[model samples]
Target: MHILILGAAGMVGAKLLQRLARDGQLGGKTITKATLHDVVEPTAPEGCPFPVEAHASDFARPGEAERLIAGRPDVIFHLAAIVSGEAEADFEKGDRINLDGTRMLFDAIRRIEGYTPRVVFTSSIAVFGAPFPEAIGDEFFTTPLTSYGTQKAIGELLLADYTRRGFMDGVGIRLPTICVRPGRPNKAASGFFSNIIREPLNGQEAVLPVSEDVMHWHASPRSAVGFLIHAATIDGERIGPRRNLTMPGVAVTVAEQIEALRRVAGEGVVARIRREPDPTIQRIVAGWPRRFDAKRAEGLGFKAEAGFEEIIRIHIDDELGGRFVA
Candidate 1:
């Protein structure tokens, strides 16, 4: 099978690339070729059994999407987008990269004759607006308040419609806030969810821009990568016409998260988290969904960390070499 991965330089994209290189296959088939595309050139993985190509290209450009789709890869993992904060702050850039770019990809695929590849789209929980119940259900209506979420909602609709038309086999998974993201924080309004755990674990101070009682759905980097793989490989027919599904994740508050860090590392690590609320981030996060039922994802075989405690351990294992200064 030939595979194409867009946004291959980001955290999740890079991890997915590493996983693919390690296994050298996807969905029980040997990968014959892999193309990695990003706004900037992605690194080509070495020592792979199959040929690998990395390109610096923008899908939003007129002909770029068509060029990327020309070879008709067996599977296409679409993970490119402007994050919520940046998208909300810059409407034009968000629309160009997130909305128009996705449409271009779909249209490019439609232009392909007799090519129906499996597509795994990485969606976000921000698609659901505020006034949520204790848990957001699978049937919850999406009323996105943020531009990023709005773009993803539109993408989900397009994926379903395109799949029904037989242009592509598409699966959209709404991922939770990926906690303990292994890098410097990006411009995401939700970056604090990972920052609180990641920086402190590294013996660096992290600012908490929200209250301790603030709750949100979360998953580990490991679980995020797993969700993408499962969505790519699962039986599309079983997914039915819904096409898009919310992934399962742990529901925990900032207090519970810090407690978990304390348990895993020590009070010193947890103490590194400073409480200095940013009203803008607080307002944005307050408008986001804090929990999810995730029954459909559970039934569909998607999994996540059991709780905040387990999430912390997964981060240590995956990004910290299983050790941290207490």
Candidate 2:
């Protein structure tokens, strides 16, 4: 099987690339070729078993998506996007890259004759809006408040409609806020979710922009990669016309996360965290769903991290060599 990954340089994309390279197969089929594409050229991971190609192409550019789709990959992981804060800050760029770019990719695939790739789209919890009823279920209506959320919601709709029309096999996995994300924080309003854990582990000060009682959904980077892999390999027949499904994740508050940190690294490490409320961030985060009843995704064989402790442990093991300073 030939695979293509867009946004191949970001955290989740990089993790997916490493996982694919190490395994060298998907759904029990050997990967013969893998192509990585992003706005900037993505560096190929060393010692990839399959033939790997890296391309720098903007999906919004005319003819770019068509050119990329010409190879007719067996599976495509569409992960490129502008994060929440950046999207809200720059509306035009967000719409151009997040919405128009995704549409171009779908249209490009539709134009392909006798080619139906299994598309695994990495959606976001941002698709759901504020005033959530405790836990959001699959039946809940999407009313995104941010431009990024709006774009992902629209993409989900397109995926379902195109799949219903028999144009492609698509699975849109609505991802949770990935916790303990490796490397420096990006523009996402949820960056604090990772910062509070990641920074303290490295013996650095990290800011908590929201209150300790503030709760939100979360998953590990490992689980995010798992979701993408499952989406690529799972039986599309069972997915039916509904191409989108909410992924399951842990529901925890900042206090619970701090407690987990104290359990693992003691009060000294936990003390590194500083609480400084940002109302802008609080408002944006308040509009995000705190929990989900992802029954459909769970029943469909998608799994998530057991809890916040496990999520943090996975981050330490995978990204920090399993070492934490007391």
Candidate 3:
């Protein structure tokens, strides 16, 4: 079966691509083709068994989404979006890419003849606004606090509606903040979450933008790829009309993260984190959901790291060559 990935160049998308290349199958079918797309050209997975195509294209532009969907891939993973901070900072750009682009993609699929592909959309926890429940539940209403969250929520709704109409088979999973992210931090206000753990382990000083008491949900990159795969292969009939799902993750505060880092890489690594407050980042992050029940995802067999320490270990194994500065 042919599979298409939008926003296939970002960190998560790249990881998912490598994973697909390694597995070489989805939904019990041997993957014969993989097409990668992004605003910036994506690099196709190397040594892939299937024919791989990487192209530079913006889905928000007219005809691009349709052109990508024209292949009628058996599965579509929509992982592209303007990140939280960028989306909040630039309203129009975020709306265009996150909302319009997604709608266009779904509409294009809906217009297709005798075609209904499994669509795995990468949503965000930001979909739940402030005044949140102690543990956000599967039935929690989406009241997004950020433009990025708003965009994701809208996309989720669209995915549900489109699926309800038999236009597509969709599953939208809201991912948590990925900790110990490899490489330099980007514009995401949540970047500090990974920076604090990632930089310290590399023996570099990382600024802690939020207070240690601040809590948030987290998952490792490896687990994130697993969630995508599970979403792509799971029985959509079991998902019913509520196509979006809040994925399970470890919930911890900045202090807990520090403790986990200390436990994994020692106090020497922990001390490398410098506390420098950024009100902009703090405010944006403050509005994010701190925890989630995610019972549905767990019931559906999706899993994540058991704890923050496990999340740290995953980063060391996957990105740090199982070693770090002592």
Which of the predicted structures, 1 or 3, would earn the higher lDDT when compared with the native? 3
Candidate 1 backbone collisions, by pair = none
TM-score of each predicted structure versus truth: 0.97, 0.98, 0.97
- Determine which window of 10 residues in candidate 1 has minimal summed lDDT: 43-52
lDDT of 2 at 287: 75
lDDT (0 to 1) per candidate: 0.90, 0.90, 0.91
Residue-level lDDT of model 1, residues 1-326, one tens digit each, is: 88999999988998888888889888889989998899888886667678888889778999998889778899999999988878988999999999999999998998887888999998888888888888899999999988999999999999999999999899999999888788897667888889888888888999999999999999988899999999989998889999999999999998998898888889899989999989998887787888899999999999998888999998899888998867
- Kindly list the per-residue Cα lDDT of model 3 for residues 1-326, writing each as its tens digit: 99999989999999999999988898679999998999899887669889988889778999998889777899999999999878988999999999999999999999986789999999998888989988999998988878988999999999999999999999999998887789996656778899998888888899998899999999999999999999999998887888899999999999999998888889899999999998988887777789999999999999999999999999999998899888
Candidate 2 wrongly placed segments (more than 4 Å): none
TM-score of 3: 0.97
